[model samples]
Target chain A: MEKSKTNPNKDFYGKTLMGIEIFVRSLIEENVDVVFGCPGNAVLGIFDALLEISGIKIILARHEFGAVLSASGYARATGKPGVVVASSGPGASNLVTGIADANMDSVPLVIFTAQVPTKLIGNETFQEVDIVGITRPITKHNFLVTKIEELTSTIKSAFHIATTGRPGPVLVDLPRDILAEKFTFDYPEKVNLRGYNPIYSAHSGQIKRAAEIINNSLRPVIIAGGGVTISNAFGELRELARKINSPVATTLMGQGVYPEDDQLSLGMIGMHGTWYANNAVNESDCVIAIGSRLDERVTGDFNKFAPKAKKIHIDIDPSSISKNIKADVPIVGDVKDALKKLIPLVKNLNNEEWLSQIKKWKNEHPLKYKSTDKVSVPFVIEKLRDLTGANAVIVTDVGQFQMWTAQFFKFLYPRTHITSGGLGTMGFSLPASIGVAITVKDRPVISINGNRGFQINLQELATVTAYNLPIKILIFNDGHIDITRQWQELQWRKKFDEILIDSSCPDFIKIADAYGIQSFRVEMANEVEPTLKKALALKDKPVLIEFKTIYEENIFPYIPLGGSVSDIIEH
Target chain B: MRHTISILVENKFGVLTRIAGLFSAKGYNIESISVGPTEDPSISRMTIVTNGDDDQIEQIIKHLNKLIDILKVVDLTNEPFVERELALIKVKVNPYTRGDVIEISDIFRAKVVDIGPTTLTVEVTGKSDKITAMINMLAPYGIVELARTGVVALKREFKGEVYTSKEIKLIKKKSRQKQVEDDEKG
Candidate 1:
């Protein structure tokens, strides 16, 4: 208990500590058990400190990208903020995409990148890059510690900003010279931040007004997003929807916010949303957007998105409220708090006719893929979901496999679905799944990725073997980027730069084997289920199942860009 | 719609870039912006003047508040506020136009701080409109150079609230009415 404002460098009890040691102590205080990162010469002082500490453990990945992505997955699996400590220049630069992924997904992560000496900052020294400047836009907030005295308080602030109100990644860059310098460790007793207040509860008047509008509507629908998962508002979302007898549709990030198997569930909504979900949104009389930004991807066309409906948007960020669509009643608060206030005020009315209409649409436009001799990605996902009993954490890299999993997998619990939704960073799943497996030990952690994207962080397989994280990885090996190839074929593939077909055909099984991971390849449809069951059952070793799916299989019920929900293309 | 927004932020390096980056990233244009340290050396104030419709301006204000270093944000567009800007205009002053240039500077209440052999520099502090008017008058004299400190603004003391977002105008009006009714009752 020390006052940092009066004398920041004051010794707590007439003793000084190295900056890196102080950081390690602060991590222990923050209840962080492990940090994911790759160490370098710039951060050698930190590694020395870690060598002496027994309170914390560190996971060293092959690359900075893997390390950062692992931290992101760790944050998503647990509500607490994840931590990453990387070296300067290339190490920090390699983390850009993963850090952006965390920012876009609102995953809480506190990243530390060791910098060169203060004098060498502008002199173009070895391994010197303006990482703080490069990551400014992507990070929620960042701080560069030029003075040793400010290190402790800045780390505290970084954690606070990363974990609270619309959670996102924050970075703290410390020069090696500062870390090596001796400074008094004054851990402030209280956090004093003037500009970082987050509204946690809804204004009573706005909540009441929204409730009244929702109660009076004949057709009501709720669109939940990742914020629900971050807020732990799944129970509240369920309660509000059930009370109002409303159907629930979700954005890609909103996968597990509501149980997909429930009668009131309309699977994921928007671009690759279920036909019934998209139909319900288009035809609803009222649209209640909770914990979601109502992003352009989720709203196929802004003008036509829930156009006729009376809108109620509940989110932590005010800017997210009317950025894309002007909400009729914009409630700037945490969705859980807003929904808790809303459920009590709304009247319980069963819209039997509306529910029946949605049911009819579901029957007519069910998620269907042409079953052939070649096993499909959708089929594998369905098998994977069934084998895991809808309890495993599903992490997806970006592409058609991502959409397929969203379409077929039925998630029953919150924090059980993890993916690179907003930034859609390729090769995110392997490292992220390792983080997920570490955090959630009892349940299975599965990383489903496309062939080309999986190689983005294939080096992480060594980290996986090193740590012995018992996670399952699947690469739908259809060669080149399937989603891009699909779009090309649909619209002038002949005229464009040579179609990327059968490119980047790496032997994933061989690659996984080289890293000493148990890998299996399934060429036939019958081998998929048995292989998945066996892979998911392994408790000590990580497993990689290469499902040789056809590259031409495209995700359907896709709303073309600039097209409304009604303009879904079935081909 | 044009808006004058005043923001107080923690005095730190790179805060200006964060603010400027937000405007450009969102595709919003900042017509003119001015920033400097406030009375408290640890904090700085920024005055931003931008043109956009109501929705666009609303987003800008909300995004500004979202930045971690920003302490306070107030839109002085709808309030009674005093605005001032400093401009230095270097004008060509030949013998014929020298008297005319001095007369124009005196008419605008500007000071001819420096008088060179061929150029007269006028230092003026006034509302943006007044400065613009003087610049127009001196333009015919072949102005050599011009520099302006974008308008700095502060609301009149009678306007109470120091912090604002979206539409606190309704709250202010309601509170004023309540006060009036209480005064009558008393």
Candidate 2:
């Protein structure tokens, strides 16, 4: 609760401070509570400055990738800009995947990477790399800070750019000398970038046109995306849906935007989405897509996706409006503001026949999985959700388990279901879960990862135990990359190739023990519920539970690549 | 179709590279690019020429506008505009060909800026087509080297207001209200 003596009012204006300390103080001024990163040779000065900081907590991950992923998770959960730091050369290079993942998912992160001294840069110094050049394409904006005078302003600009208008990752590469240099700690109170204004309110003319279209259409569907959650417009979205009497469908990334328990909510739509949701999109006369780019996974074929419907696209990013599919009515603005403008102008519609047809499809296909004595992934996900209730945060890695968790786990609130839907990174769950635990201390955090994917960043077990975070790590041990095996079985005649990881995989329980965390392995169906209960009950420390699931089990109701959503193969 | 886009950006290091990197990474080809400082020393204007369909050009403009350093982007192809390019051509010539080259330059309204014993450098500023024609006419003398200043453009007179003054006032008011709401939330 102690405040820094060097407040922004007087003492901090012209007071001399190390560039590193000024940077840390700027983070404090921005109300950043925690940062995730690993230290290296070039960033020793920064770590030294952080050592004396009282308010900020730094979670040290075993790897740079883990640090960045954890920062991404923190950003997604808290709706704040996550801060991450890394060293020069390979350390900075290691953060590329996580940075790109965050960019694809529109998570706001301010990444700081150390560089070799300004003189040694471009001369192949021991740990020097052109990190700014390397990350230019992935970052929303980046800077290579060489002057001490520009340090504070650059950091401020980086945070502003990262958290504003269609948020994404921004990087600031600081040379060693810059961090070690002495300068006046003057942090700017406001950002005045003339070129960086974002349109937040929808144009009245466009909103009126959209309402007219909605009123005229016989059957309409509202397809919401991650923007709904990003803008915190779920309440407005639900209100607009009810006003128009339209069924709502969400993209895979848009899962938690609309409550799955609602009567009008058609679960996720697209590849691995619900049958009724896909059918509803294909059959509707008007499709109102808000904040989603309509990626290939969501729209099977660009030309065929919602072919019969008059599509209206609304988004904050102007490029995403008609980049993939042409929009009949394009409104460029923030989703929350656009929905607020639209709610009053739109009138109700009587689509009873359309709703009944969608109801029939939901009853017919209804996301079924084969019942067996062996433990199944979907069953475990359902049981976990039931036992944990809807309040717990669920994060999953990419694979069959991600889809199963997306399908079976009914999320009733926003920010509760976090996954890497865009970049589809494999080793994201564990570190991200640690981040979620840091942000939402009151809620239980559950991380689900497949065996092969979990081993990618298993070193984070040390981080989990170091913080003693009460996160429950659930590993679905399918003995291989089950999604790949499923593809080979259906298309390649079960050649199998090198997908098997049964023999080479380490004993997860022993691995957990090595990290000083409690571990459990459940092989039978009867033991699954009891073991999960035990894992969730451990509130003092972290626990890892490995569920031995059926190896050959495949996700059902999958729409093959390049296939139409209406042509889903449900087995 | 070929499109010409003019962008105003902050005069800062790596701004050009960032814009160029975006085009190359997205597989968009740039025919020519020219940048220079405006009356405001803190800002620079860049003119880029590229060929793409209507949709592709819209996307290019959108991406260009997304850069934080960029102040504004306008596609000259979408409006009635005046465009010009400047070129300096160094032509290898002998005494016999010198007279003919000078005559051709005179016909094209180009001036001879530099003259050597073996080469004559002609300076021409006009529409891109005129510059191209001048270069072609002097090419018969075995051109030694050539440099071009790409293309710079500006829209003609205002046709009318794209958005009514009333609408503009409403837009400004709405944006201000939204900002106040955001500040309240923060």
Candidate 3:
């Protein structure tokens, strides 16, 4: 909620102030500590303003994609709105994927794309692209500031909207001239928008009804997601789970919000989830879904997903409710707020019988890897988790390594595990960890990437070296895009793409060396521990460790496409 | 089922595209939508007509509310409402058929707004059904041109306005600020 009611400008509403200075001043007022961007001609005025500003630090990302991804990591880590700016045309276009990633994951980002001059907007001027038009569907909301008068309010509203209910990226595209233009400016003390109102708390009546359903349910389960982390509802989630004696299964994004090692934790649920979690959810009589969207990945086959469960969904966005599975009791508010009200209304009933049944299932079908002679990726993940004591901030790229990390690594704290769960964007971790490392200076931040994905944004190695962010880059080298290969192996008669060729894989250690970063390669199972220890011990600079594992290990506990929990692959 | 959705939105340039983009992205076809300014100059009212099942219609309203520029959404689909469409039909006419064309329009309570060399342009405002009947009656005369203001509607009860109580307070504060400024000047 906007608490500032008095317009600090007082008598200066119409007083002429340079647009460029107001831009920087507004960010300072918002308490923005850092900005990530690559400058171009269209952003000249922004660079000028930053030249005069003292406190705000501007870091140049090697690529525009890296800038936005780094900002996404920062937003997830610090729970503050991330800021990133880019120049017109190609620069603006490059930030689309990263912005879309943030949008999909509900990460709050305020992006500014400098545009060509207003007069040349439609005339196809040099280096001109309709970025606002391009980013329209991806962004939560966006503004094209044609007038200098609307600049301050647009910026204020962008920040407000980005940080509020169901937070996501909001872009503000400024024409170059508007930035340079002299405008009568006064920053609004409070944002007044007719169209935007976010519900912070839910109805007590709904909470009582949900509690009633829980009390009567003999088999109950809780599915948590990033919203749990975003709302900081970990304690409330734990309390609700213990009070009801329900097993907690999280979406891939919700990995660390509920400690994975907790007895109630069902690890991660979905296509690559534990068999026990999937079965528990499928057989549940009442499912309390807190802050998770229950996307297709989480609910494998909608027809059979929690088939018997009377769902009570708590989320800040009303649209997120019943977008997939219908909510029996939809509490439309902040998950944290709803959970707080709900904890008091519930009975302290531990369904010991139900929990014991889940424990038997977990024992029968535990998440484990084969006793392979080649280096095991899952073992490496587990060793690293054990070495870090499950407190390291783990960021990952898409595919097999990501699934393995979610399965083996037990995250103990909220925001400890970040990945491109929804968008599944490749090469997300390398740049995103830069954001996490920059925000969290005290914690050990690790970027775990597959060999194929690490090469996608390899240019960010220069950025990692320049910033000296102590991010341990763990590349699971299996010499193939194993996820697609797994599909080929299962669906086809082993006819594959050129994914298995050794010539296609690059030596990441040499690449890290070229970037002047400390590099290591571990090829033996025994070598994983000593190398990880060495890498995590080096606190001053970034290190890249490439782990060479068997090329053909497929992620199991699989749910076939359009397949239900009952049809889960056990082996 | 066809749903008549009335949305109160901020009168901004991108509001139209945002609404249009939202519907298109969700794979729903918008049959007809008309937007015009409300009594409050800063607010615009958009009436969108679309076809979907109950679940789809509910999802549509939720998506509309999700847009930041959309202030209020009322699915007046099931309510008692008054609906109207205004149409200007220009029909090809001979000197001999001009009188007959005037009589046909007159029967529908329409007006002959203009008479060209070989065309009788008639202006009609009524419910969409009535407008459809009038156009069909004139179809034999070789309709030359047609322009329509697609379905604009209002509930019979007139429940509320676009601004909320919070907006009124802000407006009062603004007026008070203006009063202080005027007093200082005087």
Clashing pairs in 3: none
Candidate 1's C-alpha runs over 4 A off are: A1-14, A497-499, B159-186
DockQ class, candidate 2: medium
Candidate 2 lDDT tens digits, B82-153: 788999999999988999999999998889999999999998999898998888888778999999999998
Model 2 Cα shift for residue A551 (angstroms) = 2.2
* Candidate number achieving the greatest TM-score relative to the actual structure: 1
lDDT of 1 by residue, A449-496 (tens): 888788788989988899898888888988767888777776665455
Candidate 3 lDDT by residue in tens digits, A502-535:
4667778789989999999889988889999999
Worst 10 residues of 2 chain A by lDDT: A1-10
Q: Lowest summed-lDDT stretch of 10 residues in model 1 chain A?
A: A1-10
| For every candidate, C-alpha RMSD to the true structure in Å | 5.2, 8.9, 10.1
Number of clashing pairs per prediction, in order: 0, 0, 0
* Candidate that beats the other on DockQ, 2 or 3, i.e. the better one: 2
Better TM-score candidate (1, 3): 1
Once fitted onto the true fold, the runs of candidate 3 whose alpha carbons sit more than 4 angstroms away are: A1-17, A499-503, B95-100, B158-186
Candidate whose DockQ is highest: 1
Evaluate candidate 3 and give its CAPRI docking class based on DockQ: medium
Return the DockQ of model 2. Answer: 0.62
Give DockQ: model 3: 0.59
